[model samples]
Target: MATTTGTEAPELTGLPLLGSLFDLKNDSLGTFLRARRDHGDVVRISAGPPGIRTTVYGVFSAAGAQQVLAGESANFRKDNAFYQEVRESFGNGLLTSQDEDYLRQRRLVQPLFTRRRVDGYAAAVAAETTTLIEEWRDAGAGTVDVLQAMTRLSLRAVARILFGTDVDAAVEIVEDNFPDVGAYVLRRGYSPLNVPRDWPTPGNRRAATVHRALYEVCDRIIAERRSSGGAPGDGQDLLTLLVEAESAEDGSFDATELREQVLVFLLAGHETTATSLGFALHLLALHPEERKRAHEEVDRVLAGRTPGAGDLDALPYVTRVLKEAMRLFPAAPVIGRRAVEATVVGGVAIPAGADVIVAPWVTHRHPDYWEDAERFDPDRFTPEAEAARPRYAWFPFGGGPRACIGQHFSMLESVIALAMILQRHDLEAVDTVVPVAPAITLQAAGPARCRLTPRRP
Candidate 1:
């Protein structure tokens, strides 16, 4: 590997072999902030003691992020270590696959998320949201587990609406273990140790057990649907579409492929939505003025009625609130790409197989790009304001061709979830100031607790 252009990135100094791994593992946001504060935009992450030094680059600048995620996207792929940790459970799902296989998966599954197909699922989303609100009503509103409530609501919605299944044991498995596995995979991303899945470690064993259950559930869904004369291409649910979808050259997804894709969609579809809803509610709880504005907007728009697909665009501030919340604590914090061929990130040479990190967490909060970078301002995402910034500057779902396939679906779902929650209840924070827990997704270190009081009859 030889360097050609641009200044050599300053190597970050830390303990031997472990290098910056410990710091990254413990405080990912803090470590990234300090690196940008101390070092310039492009910083060499680790040069571990002798045998372990890898050419990993932590990219903080928007231009550098663009070079990896969009400009040279073909040169970089998702077959890196962190994705590999995911591959063990997901197999060749869209999130982890590369090249031809990834392209094939994308083509097969994308149609299900198109505006029309997603529109068809709106009824289920609303119904699931209503069901959750009823459950909260029954609980009588004192110090509710906000994340837990959102998680259940989100899983039920994803399960019924997208997968077209009743919220069952399988959804429970996903709710239980997806985060655990996610935390492990992301932990491996920053830590020096690369524990093998076969090692029978507690985390490894737990992930394996959960994955097996999830796969079994996928198979069961497919089998039951088939038995009921609901074959692939039924054009009913996303699961059915994937079961039946194929390309000219690519044949149908195999049993293994179906399981992996279903699991990935289930985790990606609901986890981010739940986390975002939880954070949004928590933020509103902290700021009464914002909460009041949200309530006023909902009253003016829905007028005490339930939100529907027609009201998606009608409630712009709710969407803006979702946008700003995601900007503050993005679901996917650090998006990574490994150079399959030698490429340059902003002219800093990156050899093949080296990791390049592009973080929304860093770029979205850049003082240069964002005014009053730390404040919670939903107005920043108004069509006019959003159009003013660089496209990649505020990517929460991600960017480029390999961005989250369910982005539109996620956005619509977030709006509906938030609108419904606001219409039904006023949430007050039971605990303020939760520590950040970095995982495959970002979350509070503990359950985000809130007291929900019914705002509607």
Candidate 2:
């Protein structure tokens, strides 16, 4: 018995044949917003021949997001084209894993990110960020690319706390190949043709080479740790925890699964954290009053010392700034899921094979959920204001069972890094033009450059 999908969905008409392909590729944010503005919560944007029916249903409202993310998540699993595409470089890691296997892996990794473990990671985050600020001091008033600075700082933090290794070496490998993989993915995603990764095409070949190198990086790190009799940080960090704590053969991650977990941590943790912090610092750079307020809060909370994990609650304004920045520039702006069964989101009939997109950027800034939707106002996240909005309105870390495992870890890392930077320096925006580049992660398409000025003592 087929359940009839309720309410007719308004469709966004596009050019013949190409449909909305070019529009989505060139101006995804604009295209998504336009669909919402014109068609209400459930907007259908097709991308195929005139009547061929290869359509994508965009969920634009917070309630629509709730339908896909929380309301009926069981019917709409992560078995989608986006996950298939991401699995090319990183393999079937937790980022792309599903159902039973995913649950097993999640349970094994859950203990590694508990509050106690995350609190333990604070010292490494503070030390790495303080070192990064010191390097800016050594440069003596030189202009810096905030994104690059943040990438290195974040990668190092993950390496030391999670991998328990000398971060400089891993940082070099991560920096070299991550951008290559990301750019290749973005190009492939936007390309009209659907080329498989196994094909011998030049782009596929290049991506393969990069993924191989990335896998090798993971292999070497794991091999070294195992060869050392698995004495990883004396069994303190996640690497050691994963290796030593074997709940069951069916309950734990094996060698291959462990490698995928590392890649997930490295990319998901390192890239998203860097991107979010980059935007946070950039927002602070543009809004001096907010930055000054953040500084005051940090000063009051830390009292001239580095921010520890314990002080996360004390720095309410700093947390709000992060919350606002993520709302504006969500690291993973859009999350995709393919419906395993026929479903309706916001009263639109979604056939079984349809790809459903829940764009946080659109939902977060929806006029219905947000005031002055485009403005950078951290106060929108204050207790009273946030409590009034729909819970799904601002899910930077996503929602439901498949939410980012490192959400807590990322928050702690970002707050510590941002506060530490504010304690030592102030970022002044230099690049006036920051384009939005939709890729594996959303980042400043242009150079996220800023003037690094030391704070006056």
Candidate 3:
């Protein structure tokens, strides 16, 4: 049993019956920010009406975030409604598994993401980036929707890395269908009430179609790979590695489990990295000085050559710029979990079985930890400055055992892509203001368009 303060956290006020339903649906990011601004670190926010009104305990402070995500993580289970929806859509992979299942999956998957192994994928990342750069140049120096471009770039890159020889068969299906799948996940994940997925509603039907297509492609690729009789760990790509992963006690993931893991990889691998790179470029476009600084670093580090794993440490300023962008627009803005038992967080008592969320969108900008919180300054990530803040203050990749497994892969991909792009062209924001909304991931609510000028010729 856990001790509590016996007092509940302050609640965000809402309308009659509907509570904060409309407010959340309209602008969830703003609502979370306001909750922390007006109601303090820990606030109770409710949505929907009486019976189905879903209220979550919003832990907004870095310390509170740490408590929920790290310190007392065992008490916060991923059995929340949002995760349930994710599991249904994505499958019971590492992202949605609980307890022993998650641990076993983690053990099997960990070897593939090791620093040395992940770094080996740099050549693949560089190759895809080169292709994107060529495409942009061929299109001429005009306004480009970076978010869209990066989304495609990341999907293709990950698909290539995952599918290898079968990249052609997998890339198009993932790129075309993921948006619908993500939209469906967001639609149901936050809803206080959802009809059964088999109900054949328009949303359900579309989601089912996309989900099936995505799964079939992955299954097909996996079958082909297995039929090829190539050893799992012996292959160059990630899917081969996943297929080869084995444990003494737990054995290996079966075919269905393989599809589930592939779905998760495709979702997290492309979407989050795309969000970071898109915003990093957009932010650079808006701030001339920062962009110039980044360009200088890129030029100095790569010296008119393609970026590789070795260049990551050499490009500190560019890395910081990406860090700042992630700080401002974390891909996974809000992470949810359910309190398994009564507990106290930041002096507020949360009852057992309560829905809980740790919002990086809010914690990254916590006034106490971040001065001039809304400003974009890469210097904030300098080692000395980062050490000055609490650990959880800027968790764009999340924290704890459940933290994103693709963290290193994402950073590596973002750094290489950003460096390569900056080396070729200078950017200007066509859509100066990139408003964001919380979907399955943090998405620019409108077009994140930018104009690029060739550095030479």
- Maximum-TM-score candidate: 3
What is the C-alpha local distance difference test score of each model? 0.78, 0.82, 0.90
Instruction: Rank candidates by lDDT, best first.
Output: 3, 2, 1
Per residue, candidate 2 scores C-alpha lDDT tens digits across 214-244 of 8887788777777776644555767777776
TM-score for all models, in order of appearance = 0.93, 0.95, 0.97
- Model 3 scores a C-alpha lDDT of 0.90
| Per-residue accuracy of model 1 over 208-263 as CA lDDT, tens digit each | 78767777777888777656666334448766777678778777888778888877
Tens digit of per-residue lDDT, candidate 3, span 55-117? 899999999999998989999999987899889999999989998999999999999999999
lDDT of 1 at 135: 76
- The segments of candidate 2 whose C-alpha lies over 4 angstroms from its true place after superposition are 1-3, 49-53, 189-192, 231-233
- Pitting candidate 2 against candidate 3, the one with the higher TM-score is 3
| lDDT, candidate 3, at 177 | 90
Q: Where does model 3 exceed 4 Å of error?
A: 231-234
